[model samples]
Target: MSDLVSVAAIKDLLTECPICIEHFDDATRIPRRMPCCVQSICQPCLESYSGGAATLSCPMCRRRHNLPGGVKSLPKETVILKTLDYLKIQKGLHLPCTDCPDKEIAVAQCDNCGTFLCSICLSAHKRNTVSKTHTINTFDEMKGRPLQSFRRLHQCSQHQQPVQFYCYTCDKVVCVSCTVVDHKEGKGHNVVSVNEAHQGKAKSINDVLGKIEEKTKRLSETESALQKKIENIKLSMKVARDDINKIFDNLKDRLNQRRTILLSDVEGKSAENLKVTEEALDSTRLLLTKVKSSSEYMRQMRNKADKVEDLQVMGSSKASLNSMLKESPQEIPFDRTGVSFVQANVQHLQNTINVAGMVRSVTFSPTERPNGIPDTAVHNVITLEPAEFPTD
Candidate 1:
């Protein structure tokens, strides 16, 4: 037993339940299967979230399933049960006492009783008086232990004898007395040694290990790919953010240029209009002074001169005043225009903003995407150009 119980063998036997993180065994690692996902879920986890009004969701896929019949109705995963059994047998390789619940490792196996015993139990068994001829072998004696002999140590419940022969037809091990009775040769029973039967079980376990290894390799590859994908997505997001920011920055510069141009035009037009109005006012003042002088002269000279002299001065004043009045009408001339924003014809912007004027739709995909939408659906396109605005 000491030779069989190597460091590697003990390491291989110490496995934990995926859900509970306890030793994977018949008691704790009870497996249940979801009908929709068909994947094994540990019973402890199932019970924790089962039978509530909320539907139980698959931990792997997150797809919800109804357990109308409750948690007990979930199907048992037979494969997982077999897996646990294989693990239990591997554990027994490091022989443990049969009678105690404390998991004390046994030092020897009783050949006559077919049971592994601890130091205390072995001494007690040797002292017992049922004709103490029982042969005992220490773990050090069995340097090359046979793997199949572990399960052969159990006694048959009916005969109280060590189980030795495995009945192929019944698919179970039986005592010598059972061979004569229930497992009779007349019934064509193919009873073989415990070694052969257990060897077959070992082969089956190896097959399961092979499949698990294959899946583990695939899972590792997928994990690597997913991580790379996430990194690439983050890079893409950063690039898009920087590019969009740059585009918007340029748009702001163009807007500033437009504003400057519009304001300069208004200033130039106002300055030109101011000059025209000042010249018109100056011409009217000069004409008004001349008219006053002509009228005063006519009044002062009326008493001393004849009608011809007064009429000549009045005619010249009338001509000058008429010219000034004609020029005044032109000052009220109105053809000045003001500037405002106009809507662009771009469809995306037109659909969004109410006002229309150079509606620069900087089209971009969402930085934070909604669930279920793939990265392939994302797109970013920006266009900038000035559009004519309707004036009020």
Candidate 2:
């Protein structure tokens, strides 16, 4: 039973607090006991430690516990017994400093004094007036030697302090000190958490990039369609031009043939009229010559008096010559029955030909009556709102 008690006492002494890396001595010193009872720490260390309430765990036993409120009473005898048991167990244990040449050093830290010292240093440290009230213990008395305490490390580039927040606009991590001094006063920058800023910007960029890609695709398709339409129009225009030129050439040839025939007919009629006038003038000259020759023959036969009948014949011939000289030339009328050189329908044909190259309107007949209404009953009236149809 004594051996078992000793072993139990030795195991209890091995437990230590995870926070300050120190053994629990007096109950007054360690106000908080972990749920496992293996780990305990002084009230001052528990209060000043930054590990909030969530992560209150023992380093040695890896057990979690809650802290006691206010001051509590503890048995003085129990405290003394636990301390004596711890001292005895520590006698066999040895700790060494990593930087020492002898490879043998005491692993004791003073809680009040905030100094790490060996047994010899502890004795001398106790003698000092400033460190006399400090609690001392070996490194092995502590639960975990190397405690991992996370601290804010990155400093704001502007303020030179640990960064705690993020600036979305500038895309940088900033500190609280920076927010007040540099950001608030200097640039009035907006700040947020680093993680939030990154996520928001990623979403925004993705949305915009998606729209850009869609627009680019639509533009490419539109360009291709427009190019095809332009080529079709060009081809259509060329065909229309060829058709118009062919129609004009045929009309021009017909017009020229008609003009030539009309001119030839006019020339022939004029020449015939001139020939008739010349023949009428020649007959009048012949009658006058006959009358003059008869008069001359009557004068020569003056000795044969009382030739009245012969003289009367010469006078009648003279009268005939004078009447023929006074008569006008006969006007001949040319036959113009089949001489329509300018067709009456030519103007209408030319107007139709001129419309060949134009953009003609196409009308579509409805296959079914709109809304199943008869065309005669349906009125094509449109109503518009005041805003939509503005008055001039």
Which candidate number has the best lDDT? Answer: 1
**How well is each residue in 37-67 modelled by candidate 2, as lDDT tens digits?**
2123455565454255534444322234454
Model 1 local distance difference test score = 0.47
**What TM-score should be assigned to candidate 1?**
0.37
Off by over 4 Å in 2: 1-165, 169-177, 184-190, 253-392
Candidate 2 — which pairs collide? Answer: 107-139
Tens-place lDDT digits, model 1, residues 262-322:
3444345344544554454443433333233323322332222222222222322333333
* Model 1 misplacement above 4 A: 1-18, 21-111, 114-131, 137-152, 168-170, 177-190, 253-392
Task: Estimate every model's Cα lDDT from 0 to 1.
Answer: 0.47, 0.39
Worst 10 residues of 2 by lDDT: 334-343
TM-score of each: 0.37, 0.25
Clashes of 2: 1
